[model samples]
Target: MTHLPEPPAAPAAGQARIDDQAAKLLAAVEEAMRTPTSYRDDSPLPDYGPTPPVQQPGAPAMSQQATDVGRAAMFCGLATVPPGLIAIGILVASEHADPTVIGMICAAPAALAVPILAIARLLRSAKPEPEVHQHFHGNVTQTTTHSRTSGVWAKNINQK
Candidate 1:
């Protein structure tokens, strides 16, 4: 077999004019892109004045009043359970406590509470209450590409 050539022939000598033309065109394009002029309006966009305030919608379900009510209920439950449990022990231990009278004493708070709750509920229901319904829906997708000019330049290129 014939021996292969040691050096590859370069086209740069024969195609010098074409290479120069291509380089000039590339530079022109780069300069144009850097500060575009032809067919491009680079002036600052006409001040449309300050933008109108955007109304952001919050979750309808997570109101401050609802959170307060939930906290209040939790606090009431926590405050009431231990004492009520202890009272049961006291009732059981008292020898003078009649079986019938014990139940009435235990149920007295609840008996008073139920009617007050019912009346409060009825009074609340009686008013022509306003129904507020708010819905917020959105699909957001964001993408960002960044070049760390200073950081990249500061780094040693030879380092692995």
Candidate 2:
């Protein structure tokens, strides 16, 4: 087998200069590591004050109250579906029920529940009652009450 040629030798002056610079850089790095430098907080430091609020441009504009009402309506509408299907199934399985009657029975409750829940949510979120304060003359008694609407007829009063 033929022998491979010997590798080329490094140049004397340039190689020595590169090695000298590398050793100097390594020694500078080691000295820097041995004695650490202290950092100073310079001009325009961070303020500890509360940050300004950022408004997103593409965010939806729906109000929380409207979202809550819509969510309630959606849940009620979904809840009514299973019951409506069951009612339809029962009607269809019966011997003498007409197709139109079965359809109506299934459709009515599902159709009504959404609006009913929406109305209930609207009524629930209606403005709180006017504050009532009563003062006594002699004993200096004071009472404050808030009225909460529980249902169509009844209201529960809370005292503070």
TM-score per prediction, in order, is: 0.28, 0.29
Q: Can you give the lDDT of residue 91 in candidate 1?
A: 75
Q: Which whole-number lDDT from 0 to 100 does residue 87 have in model 1?
A: 72
The candidate that achieves the highest TM-score relative to the unseen native structure: 2
**Which digits, one per residue and each the tens of the lDDT, describe model 1 over residues 17-112?**
666689999999998889845453356654888755444559446688899999899998899888787777777787556778678777888999
TM-score between model 1 and native: 0.28
- The whole-model lDDT of each prediction reads 0.73, 0.75
* Ten contiguous residues minimizing lDDT sum, candidate 2: 36-45
* Positional deviation of residue 117's Cα in model 1 after best superposition, in angstroms: 8.5
